[model samples]
Target: GEEVAQTPKHLVRGEGQKAKLYCAPIKGHSYVFWYQQVLKNEFKFLISFQNENVFDETGMPKERFSAKCLPNSPCSLEIQATKLEDSAVYFCASSHELPNQPQHFGDGTRLSIL
Candidate 1:
């Protein structure tokens, strides 16, 4: 099984401050993904990268949310402007670029707005 690693178990930010989360994709895996859980039942896929290139970014917000999966570096998801509604758990996932290969998720980083 693949392992996805996320840093900073919790994050607290003031309103309008920037928030950043880091992720290390599983070794030998080239695909990385970021998801935001703003509610108990809501999980929104933010972005996905194949190796160092963005693969799909269906649900990412154009202005405030950006991510990078760079070679020889940990992938990063950044929120340019934090708001009360942006407080949530952010999950990082990784998988091989094969059909039916399940993505492995790390323990989410809980973000709080102050």
Candidate 2:
């Protein structure tokens, strides 16, 4: 069956270190997105991709965050030089398209910076 998968439900990192999260979108889905939820509140859009091409990434932090959708592999988001404020739930979602299709979210990768 089709489902979004995320591993390492929880992660702890020291300040100035790096954190990497993974996501596997449902099969046949063409659009993938990444979001960050701080304190389990509002979701902040980080990036979106159509197939292997990035559609939009304006919401992503320029300095330390990077993401990619690779063929035959689950999508990944990497954070460099983690900070206290970077602690949050990182969710991966996938949809057929952005206009009408609803995105399915994974349980999320809970990141804690200490």
Candidate 3:
């Protein structure tokens, strides 16, 4: 079984600062996903990648959120000019490229904006 991993378990940023997150997808997995949870019941899919190419990004905000799943490096998600509304728990997940395969998730990084 492949396991996803995330760095910086906790992040704190002042308003207008930048916030960056790192994710390591499970070995052998071809699909990578990022999600944001602002409220307990609200989990928003942010982006996904197939190998090093972006596959889907239906939920990512064009201006403030950006992500990369580059080969030979940890996948990264960044938010520029952070605002209080950006505070949330960011999750990284990975799965096989095959359709319907379950995604494995890492413990999220909690981002706090002040």
Candidate 4:
């Protein structure tokens, strides 16, 4: 498919709940991007991967937040023991490693933590 496929448009979890979001990047695209958005503001890049390996994770939270890109599987961002501050729209973009390929994005998963 040409577009990134994200599942469950909206998710609600209570404090200390475990919330998992899924993103299937455009097929054959080797690079995937992840970000967290709050109040329609700037995107904060969380992590990115090429194929199944981590390329950069400097922006990712040190704890309670985890993500994975696995072979033959959709990429995922899982929030463990979610906090009220964890609420946000998590977006993922994908493209080839080349400099000019336009990145494709998924309609972010809105995670609401109460």
Candidate 5:
């Protein structure tokens, strides 16, 4: 079976500081996705990558967030200049891009900006 794992189930950071989250997607999956769920609301797509190349990042905030998908290494999402509104659960998912292939998600890294 395949799985996605994320570290630091919860994180607290002050405004203007930085927070980094990590994720390990299932092996053999080429597409990695990152999403944010704010206040238990909708899951907003932040970015997606295919084999280290960004496939879509139109939904990502241009100011404070960035992500990377690397081979063998766990994917990472880093937020700089954190703001209170930046708090949310950051989820990492992976899929094979095949029909009926659902994306597998991690428990997520909950971030709190104060």
Candidate 6:
């Protein structure tokens, strides 16, 4: 099956350090989303991008979290000055439609703040 690819399955960083995660959405998908999972089965939408422009980022933390999706390149999510609360698994999902459409998620990158 075609799948989204996430790099560095696990990452560790000290408090106040920075963490960057990469996601390669499945080919042909036109929309990409970023999520943060803090508790099991609990996911918080962080941001989303349609092609190279951001679609929705209402859930993003204005200060420390940033994401970008550029043509012909993998999408990226970055966390600056990471805090203990930032420890979570970041997942990227892709879809062809905005709503009522099936989305595929990447393996997820687990970030641990120490």
List the global CA lDDT of all models.
0.90, 0.92, 0.93, 0.91, 0.89, 0.93
User: What tens digits encode model 4's per-residue C-alpha lDDT throughout 2-105?
Assistant: 89988779999999999999999998899999989987887899999999999899999999888999998999999999999989999999997767888889
Ten contiguous residues minimizing lDDT sum, candidate 6: 1-10
**Between candidates 3 and 4, which one is better according to lDDT?**
3
lDDT of 1 by residue, 1-114 (tens): 357889889999999999999999889898898999999879999899999999999989878888898779999999988888999999999988767899989998999999
**Whose lDDT is higher: candidate 5's or candidate 6's?**
6
List, residue by residue over 15-90, the lDDT tens digit for candidate 5.
9999999988888888889999996778999999987889899999998889988777888999999999999999
* TM-score (C-alpha) between model 5 and the true structure: 0.93
lDDT value, residue 37 of candidate 6 = 99
TM-score of each: 0.94, 0.96, 0.96, 0.95, 0.93, 0.96
Compared with the true structure, model 1 gives a TM-score of 0.94
Tens digit of per-residue lDDT, candidate 3, span 48-100: 99999999999999898999988899999999999999999999999976698
**lDDT of model 3 at residue 3?**
71
Q: Which stretches of candidate 2 lie over 4 Å from their true place?
A: none
Candidate 6 scores a C-alpha RMSD against the true structure in Å of 1.2
| Residues 1-114, model 2: lDDT tens digits | 288999779999999999999998998889999999996679999999998899999999999999999999888999999999999999999997669889999899999999
Worst 10 residues of 5 by lDDT: 92-101
lDDT of 4 at 76: 92
Error of 3 at 114 (Å): 0.5
Candidate 6 lDDT over residue span 1-114, tens digit each: 279999989999999999999999888888999999999899999999999999999999989999999999999999999999999999999998778998899989999999
Clashing pairs in 2: none
Return the lDDT, model 1, position 40. Answer: 85
